[model samples]
Target: MKNYLILAAGLAFAAPAATAQSTASATGAAAAPISAGQRKAAEELLAATDSEKNLSATIDRMLSAQLEQNPGMKAVEPEMRAYLTKYMSWPSMKEDMVQLYAREFTEKELRELTKFYQTPTGRKTITKMPELMAAGMEIGQKRMQEHLPELQQAIAEKLKSQPPGAVK
Candidate 1:
């Protein structure tokens, strides 16, 4: 149950953007405040990319995939959907997402990205991202499953080498 909830939250919040992590300080002490122009550019970029539609599609795909993998979860599917839609829908998250982009990117960068997203290639990227992400995840899962035994073995070896209670 906890895992499902976590998965739901992760899926709902996952941005299908550049897939890069921010290098900002953990405490955000080094972060600069977002300017109004930056925020506006972020909003325009999101609009050009149809982020809301992509978000909805991503959530639907994630839920359907989860249900397919765990038939027993079907009973709670409606609740899961409702919870995600109520709390994490595009309307609810748009401002925060805009802030995120605004903080991570400069106003000029955002404007350039917005322009790119208005082009044919950029439009294709937006439309194809959900499917591309799904395929990428499938590949990653397959690779992880294949190597899981090696990871387990490495952990077991490290634990054996450690002094008793040292890990704690």
Candidate 2:
């Protein structure tokens, strides 16, 4: 679960930069301070969506999930916790997450989202998001496994086409 959440979070954070494509523009955007209202609204949205609670749940499950999957890891649980704490602790990342959302959304939008998240349907969506994400990931993995031979063949063809001494 930790690995899954980390991958999900990594993709979430990376998606914006990947689309931005230029470091200078990305840096400029990062440097532009968010307005107070925007920050407040973003924080409110996070709270309404139970972002911190969700993160805590993920972290809580992580250790048990790891141990279940790899009993050998029990011997190194302390080391694993130290590493996860250093990099994945919510306290270290909450402000950055708030800023990320604030940057991506207008104050008005954030407020509207907060309002929606407070609704029953919105709450349901929040509750179901992890399950939905897991299902989608499973679907993707199945598709990838089904098509892996094609991918291997494509890679082989590409390698064959490359000059003997040159790497593609």
Alpha-carbon local distance difference test for all models: 0.80, 0.72
Q: Which one is best on TM-score?
A: 1
lDDT for each residue of candidate 2 in 1-168, tens digit (9 for 90 to 100): 465455445434322222433443456754469999999998899889888777666655656765787686588777766765666566766787777787778999999999998999999998998678668867989999999999999999999999997883
Candidate 1 per-residue lDDT over residues 1-168, each given as its tens digit? 975876666684466532333333345555567888888999999999888987887788778878888889999988988988987689887876787788778999999999998999999988887778778978999999999999999999999999999987
Candidate 1 is scored at a TM of: 0.86
Ten consecutive residues with minimal summed lDDT in candidate 1? 17-26
> Which residue segments of model 2 deviate by more than 4 Å?
1-29, 62-66
Per-candidate clash tally: 0, 0
lDDT for position 139 in model 2? 100
